[model samples]
Target chain A: MKTQKYIVIGGSAGSFKIIIRIIKFLPANFKKTIFLTLHRLKHVRSGFVEALSLKANIPIVEPKDKEIILTGRIYLAPANYHLYIEPTKTISLSTEELVNHSRPSIDLTFQSAAHSLKDNVAGIILSGANRDGAEGLKQIKLNGGFAIVQNPEECQVLTMPTAALKKSQTKNIYSEKQIIEFILNCK
Target chain B: MIKLDDIINFNNAVKEVSSYNLSDYSKKSLGRRIEKILSDYKMTIDSLIKKIKLDSNFLEKIIKNITVNTTELFRDPKIWQSVKYRVLRKLKNKDTINIWHAGCSTGQEIYSMLIILHELGIANKANILATDINTDVIEIAKKGEYIYKFNIEYIENFKQAIQVNPYNYEDKIDVSFTKYFEIDRVKNLMTAKPFLKNKVVFKKYDLVKQDNIFAEKFDIIFCRNVLIYFNAKLQKRVVNMFADVLSKKGFLILGIHESIFGAEALKYIKHGEFYIRR
Candidate 1:
């Protein structure tokens, strides 16, 4: 059986818009599992999942630990934990020290996916504060996986994505609409 | 007996030193620094001068070796801590935030920021601008990829290296920030994603040469590890440009070792990590 492809999205501050941009482009019938992570306060319940659910026909919900990642389902990391995709496509949670001072670090997700998912991974880093995903994206590209970063000009918060752009090399950088178009068009 | 002629020649040499093309740099400071280098290398002044003059490629190599890239993912942990406590506090209320990565070298720092912001539940609002002088480097930066090497040190200090949060209940996220990476045969070759596509903009810019920036203004300007390349005068000049182009209250972040120092650049402030405001 051909392994399923994983689409991972990570960001902060301006990330909500970034996720919306990509999810909007995905048709309801799309079959890929889309994983989303946005950094926020660990204690506070993020209404983002609900907010995004309104716009996306696909199931948009926070990922539960050990949950088997299903195709066409969108998994969002809960606040304050670095999210990872296991080889079994299960979700792993950690309270370990923060990379870039973030628990649910974008780099953590991207890096883990790059290792576990290999060629089936497509990692995208959006707007954020520091250079978290820069190293993770580098892994994706080295492992022969596709990687993308939002054009900082089009990003709501340019630091995170710009940091990524500064540190690692990427295949392409596109604006929000263009990113959406590319993701949806992907076979 | 003191010779007036010799004293006159010595004075002229001092003036000549000041008049060189590198006058913009503080001679004594840089001279002392280079002298230290010479001493460390156990080379006499004569040999050092000969080494520099005799081989152009060697000179280039020396300069490249000394070039302060001073970079890493989440360079200054305090900066991330500060952003988490201060900037992110405000970010929680906002729907979006835009940031500019100026003088981004291969792209580690920006991705570090994205990881933090994503953890903060604000990744969707991110807008990133990555600019640099080296077109070749910029092209590489756009790839958002890396090769990896696994080291026991990296594994042991993985938590510290990544700055992951240690407090989570219920669905604890277990992304082994270090396990994601494995060592390659090449040294320091990291395998990972640098940034997300559709989240960042990469462009070319020379802070010294450019007078105007046609691109969109930024909410935050990250010129980290870039100012060290220029002399104080050039640093001031670039600082002015950054101030002119930045939005009001926009943040300006520099390298941990770098500072706006004497420049009337931005309203320099000591936040958790060093930051400036226009």
Candidate 2:
């Protein structure tokens, strides 16, 4: 496999709806890796994966380290782990330390992906608080990757997407459904 | 006297900082910070608002400079390394090990943990909790992918620092980092596909809000490098939040550079780069 193209989705406050919308819009046989970061408590047991899996046309699974990157699989960052891509195209997890008081932090992932994935990637920042992924997304755009942001007016919590749009050169700004279409089309 | 217009700008800045909830923060200090930001950007209050309305990029730049960021990958490697050697042996019989990577950034440290656990053969049996105040970073972290431009030369140094074989792993894979990641043809741009979202449950959380943090306890709350940003009182308060939510005897790994020195914890144990259970 040509190391499935990577799509990163980040959001907070009201990301649940956006994430599901994207999953629903994706083609059943979409051949890319979908990584998502949502805002939730560390200890709460959420049916997020199950919920998304049911709605998504593709298989949704919590990723495992060294698991071969496959096409058509949707992966979520399990609660409390910073998700990173290794040079080997294998998943690398870190227990390092929080950035902006968040683990599966947006900056950490986006910065690493910008450093590793380069132009073969797509980054989207959704409704959220703080400016976490702003710098990372900036790096992504600077690295020739496609950057997108949710229209702030459309977000329940516009801090994140607004911040991203403010700092980086996003290739497109869309509603959740449009974002999914863009990703699918890109693939 | 502070300019009336400046005061308005400061209020706007404060509103932005706390997401329009400046009721809790001190106006004077917040205003000073905002003034500094405005001056640095060479923007008038009117210009600033215009930028916020017309240019989202300017807003992000202001936010990045104003926000406090405390992050490090494998922050306290020793604590994690110890967990691998000492704790794993004792907890081996347990079917699963749930870890909370509290405030996990871009997931670098989380990736390190996953790599270590996978090497330890304990990953399949583990569940990770990656949370952060910045959902932007968390979303990016979920990608599990990174670019290695400036850091490419550090591959050997990173391996040496972490005592892992970066080159050896490449030998097993058919694709080189260059194959999947698109290196900038000109500038130092590098980006790659994320590989870790499959295993993490990323969420946005505000530690200041008790409701945001659930009523459950965790086996390990690896909160590192983030405490330094908050004022001392806030740090203590946040530590209490961790202490309240942590399972008894469960480890709390802080950044190697951070210390719980005089927090409310009964006591702390140092293991490598982290400070563990009380």
Candidate 3:
């Protein structure tokens, strides 16, 4: 019943639009667990889970600290916390010092996902204003996981995808629609 | 190229040299922490292996950095609200109340509890034991001060928890932020009021090892955000220890997101976000 082993997605400023678009198309019965980490301002009230759950049929959650990671749902990293995936398949949250000036670091999540899920995972980097997720996607590739980045030209902010291109060992450059296609065919 | 095997071997060496067992920790997060140390010291994996053998302090450096000690004051206000209204409310009539703030890193949670007790008029009748695995954080926790730049979420959480009239609540907590906290605008830091500092007795206690540091059983045990570092087996064992140290009706409060997932979970009944041994 593995739709995909696991999906690790990273984005920053302009990511939700593409993320929502992809979520809109995923089946309610999607089998893989999706972990999303986005850069956000510290102390912003969390409406992220509610907001992402609006059009997405699958269950979306801002996971609690030490919460079990379940399949067939999406887990969003709470603002101002670093999310780490454990080998026991649970998620842990920490208030450890911010990296790259971002607390919900894309690189940290991606890197953790790379090791925990290993080659059975796929790393997707979407639109963002910063270079936070580039090194993370590189980690995914190093661990033999599938690494894909949105085309920089198609991005609202090209810095993130362009940096991923320079930093990560990815050959799959996807556009919004192509990214949707990749997710749909993930099994 | 750094392989997972290399990290595993390093963890094994760490265990052999120092009784610190990291084998159960998630390799990915462990790998990243190791990588961070390597980069910070500008040493390769092999170089780290050599340095680990050559240097005794190297392992402690990794331990200090790797343990997630980062937490803020009044974290997860909803849980605090429950502690006040549900857990503490039950013990309000007691002559004396005792609390164990396990893994009380930097003392934020302990101080927050003291404030609640103060507001409840039980601060004088309370005994608080705050302990952490890291002595460095224990020192800071003893000081009872924190960074001044308050996270807006913290303010919001605090606002929701205080239901009494705002002025009366202020009057109840007469010291206020101004008196208890010496906020330095230029330094952007806040120092704890001496009163709160006096309430807590801090000690260094590791969750991994079994010890009878405190003979008295606690009415409330607040161990939040510390178990995530442990694997399922360790989490189970520690939860049992928490059970051992807690009174029969005493409450075990975990971080809002933390759940007691293993069979040891059967030991307690879930009461909202907390667990109670019935």
Candidate 4:
């Protein structure tokens, strides 16, 4: 039996529609545990999960603190909190000061996944206006995990993926369709 | 790199040398905190362990740094709005409403509650007890002073929770900031007025020990944003402890994203963002 894979997808400004498309594309039986950390307004908390869930084939959850990690489900970072992937296979939320001017920071979640799961992780950085996910993608590569970014030309906002490409040496840049194909092709 | 083994060793060393028991904290969060401490101080794990063994004062500072004290007034304004309409309104008829703020950090939350209670016209009937493991934070909570500019953004939360009625857009109540706090921009200080700070008692208490020092049952308990530091097992234990001390049909208010799970969750009825003790 193969070990489970942890897939982390991070985005900001322009990645929501793309995320919905990805969620719509993935099959219900997808075995990898998916973690989504998106930059969101701290006060507006209710609509994001519900909107994402409308077309999702797999279960989408904004996980509570210390919730057990399970395969075949998507976990979202709640607003105004930093989400961490624990070594004990549980999720932990932190109210620490914001990093990169964002809570549910892409860097925190990606770095945590890299540190805890090592080579069993795949970190994907998508379109955004800021440089929050850049160092995190670098950490993912440094930890022997797969680091991927959407191609800058294909991104709605090029700063995020471009920064990620400059920081992380990984050559696994993909278009939206190619990213979906890459996820589907994973064993 | 600080591994899980290093965290385990640190926990054991702290347990043997002091009254603190950190073995129950979530390893991933604790490990991250330890790694930050090591980098901040430029010390190795072995050196950190040696300092912990030799100096009790340094150990206390390390323990204080380990616990997170981040908080704001009227955090998650919607929850406060729910508290005004849902929780406190239900308990308004009682002669004395006892509320416990477990793990209350730097006093903003307590003041936030006082503002709500005052607005509801039930401030005088409430008795509040706030506690935390960190003595430094307890003192800050006692002082009821904070950096004005640092917390200026949360004033919007005040307007959202107190001034504007969510259900009715036309119904608006004008509440002044001067009613609860005195903000001095020149000095960069916001001090909670006497009426808000006088009703609450502050103390140093550790939730991990499961000891109820007050020996009094509470009508409502606020343990917001604190349980995320503990593992599932410890979280369950603390939830059960809260269940034991809460009055029948009392409320347990956790953080917006925090939850009670396992057998302990059955003791409370989930109502919106909070749990009602059954």
Candidate 5:
């Protein structure tokens, strides 16, 4: 049985609104840990958590370094650093050089989680301007994890999903509404 | 497919070669590194095991890449400003100061601290103890030579690193980067002055399961951005060790995004983004 122990959703540019809509549907009793690795300016102070928490039934938090990763919760990567899921299931943040000109790069989180969690990882790629998550989503599939990419035709920017499609062997292509259903089904 | 047995053998091979235990490091991270090394070098786990046994220098290459974390100069500048206004200024009258920098990768923060002490004119009175687990990084730290930073990147990092100073933002006073750094714009190399490097004693001490190397109690300890690699239990153990070595008024600093939570939080008193031993 392929149990979805971890769910990581990634996006950039125009994916925030879609994420909020998706997050709003996840129940508080969801049995897996969820991570949101969205692209944002390192210097800008964003109210992302406060905004998401208002609608999310489950706890939505911007993780502090060394913070424990609990089940049934949502974690947003803070800006300006690469977020890693350590073996102990705690969070490790690295300000290492940016990949694809972005810190909190979706690829870093997705790749780390895929390596650490292995087959238990389920990844979803959303609208983005870059190809960061493409390789990582492919890595997830290589590690025996499941992958879903938002249909490029439905995305605000098609490059990210299109790039992800080139690498990932996913049959679970879905629009925004269907992606929400896929998330709920994982629970 | 990589199985649990492969991971166990890899850790055993690492221990046999380096005499350092990788058993306690997060298996997830270790696995990631192992996977990367395999693909990058075109070797399977079994071949890598053979390389570790036959090749003497193989372990060193893996260890160096494993321990490196992101570090920058005067990183998270608000913390420096807080140190300046709250901690250093309060201790200015002291005849001597002891500062311990744990996991001081390549001495960026050490130079940054030296700059702060120099700006405060207390550089003469302070003795800094800087250490990292990596011997190579320690050697570089001892030299105190930094390559020049590009202006655009430097300015961008500076803006993000520092919290806007109220008066400086209002009055538009700019920071003169040259005051603390000796920059050779032509040679594209910046070397930290001798006065700062002279005061620092660099040692190789492992924070995890290592014997005590530091005998002197410190007035300030900078253990920033290192603990995130460890699990919660290890984080507590390391922080408690810091507390044991700290003086009553000693300051303990963490990364901008790290916190002193749980029972360990009781040992420190928070003061405007800085923490002091209670």
Candidate 6:
């Protein structure tokens, strides 16, 4: 059996457009499971998934706690909750204290993926104003998983990618096009 | 920087030394929480295990810390709104309302329900029982006091769930904070009024244990964010237990971000934010 692949993408601030672009480019049969954790207004819960689903070829889900993880789908960490990837390949949500002033914390999701999936995981940090994903991407690298960052120069807000790059040397610092191509070519 | 092996060893140690069984906790979160404990005590996992074997009091403390006690007043107001209009309204005709706040942390939720019941004129008919594995939180729940400054924002939740009627824009009631709890801003304290505090019976109950010591079926069970900490098997078991303890057509309310899945999902019908026992 082929090893399952998992991709975790963390973004905040100016990363929404980049996420939409990546989703638009992926085909309906994308095999790898994708987890997206973005900073969102906690009170405004209804629109995020609907907006993402409009152009995505694959199913986009805001999973509830302990929901089974499935391939060929995109999971968005719901607002105001931290998302954790379990060794059982299930998603667990927490209303624990916020980390880096955000819930659906990028670091929490990325770290959980790195720990649970190990070498089969890929952690990507995108345009954002904060340093939430820096330590998480570092964990991904330490766990022998792929760690990629959006090229800071190409980002609307460079702080996130720049912080990630400074925390640990990532495998790739790619533009949006390169990022999309890398995902598309994943087995 | 705890490894998976360390977590496993710790879980084994906990189970062997105490009645608590932590093997079914979700690994990632459990690992993270254990890491925090190690850092807090500045001890290695080996030392922690050694301590667990030596002192039962320390073991109790460790278990309390392991269980996440993060809860707030009307943590998700929309669910409480549904409880008011959809759930409690339907139960109004019942001779008595039996409510179980499973895993009730620090008692804000119990008080929240009391306020709602009081507003709905069904306070006298309600019997509320709140439980948690953490004895410290049970004490705090019994006290019904919280940090006023920290929870000042949740006052809005009270307004949203109690004062505003979502279906009718113009239908609104002015409920002062004083009616439910006294806000002593100067002392940084918010204490639940006696009527709300005295109505609830608090107990220390473990969800992982199959025993239902309450010996009574409930009309509503609010487990909320508790199940997110458990692995799938444990979640299924607890959900099944809730199903058994619930009266026919009784409701099992979870956190806004929680849901029932797998074989256990078959036991209840999804009703908006809650599950109805079929």
List DockQ, one per candidate, in order.
0.01, 0.03, 0.54, 0.75, 0.49, 0.65
Worst 10 residues of 2 chain B by lDDT: B20-29
Which residue pairs in candidate 4 have backbone atoms (N, alpha carbon, C) closer than 3 angstroms, thus clashing?
none
Q: Which candidate, 4 or 5, would have the higher DockQ against the true structure?
A: 4
How good is the docking of model 6, by CAPRI class? medium
Of candidate 4 chain B, the 10-residue stretch with the lowest lDDT total is B208-217
Error of 4 at B220 (Å): 0.8
Per-prediction CA RMSD (Å): 24.0, 21.6, 3.8, 2.5, 3.9, 2.7
Candidate 6 regions exceeding 4 Å error are: A1-4, A154-156, A185-187, B1-5
lDDT to native, each model: 0.64, 0.64, 0.79, 0.89, 0.80, 0.89
Q: Over the stretch B1-278, how does candidate 5's per-residue lDDT look in tens digits?
A: 36668878988987887766666665555665677778878999999888887776777777666675566677766677677667887778888889999999888889878877876689998989998888889888888676785533444444433434533566433556655557787888777777667888988878876568777888999988777666567778888999888889899988878888889889999776667898
- First chain TM-score, candidate 4: 0.96
Total clashing residue pairs per candidate?
Answer: 129, 82, 2, 0, 0, 0
For candidate 1, the lDDT comes to: 0.64
lDDT tens digits, residue span A1-187, model 1: 2233788888887787667766766788888888886787543444667888888878986764445788888998766555777676677554334668776788878877887788898888888877888898888778878888899997777898887877777747878887787677665
Fraction of reference contacts reproduced per prediction? Answer: 0.00, 0.04, 0.71, 0.92, 0.62, 0.88
TM-score of each: 0.43, 0.46, 0.86, 0.92, 0.82, 0.91
Taking the tens digit of each residue's C-alpha lDDT, what string does model 4 give over B62-113?
9998998888899888899999988987899999899999999898889899
Model 3 Cα lDDT, one tens digit per residue, A68-129: 78888889888877898866787877666788888889988988788778887898998889
lDDT string for model 3 (B89-115, tens) is 898888778899888988878877887
Candidate 2, CAPRI quality class derived from DockQ: incorrect
How do all the candidates rank in terms of DockQ, highest first? 4, 6, 3, 5, 2, 1
Per-residue alpha-carbon lDDT of candidate 2 for residues A1-187, written as tens digits (9 for 90 to 100): 1222888777777777878777888888787887776656643424768877888788987664334567788777665566766446655444434666777788767776776788887888999887778988888789878788998889888888888998996758888678867777766
Best by TM-score: 4
Candidate 1, B96-207: lDDT as tens digits: 5778788777776666677667666787887787877555556656664554443233233334424544332343445565333344555666544433445777887656
Kindly indicate the candidate among 1 and 2 with the higher TM-score.
2
- Candidate 3 residues lying further than 4 Å off, grouped into runs, are A1-5, A64-70, A85-95, A116-119, A142-144, A169-171, B1-28, B44-59, B150-157, B163-176
Backbone clash pairs for candidate 5 read none
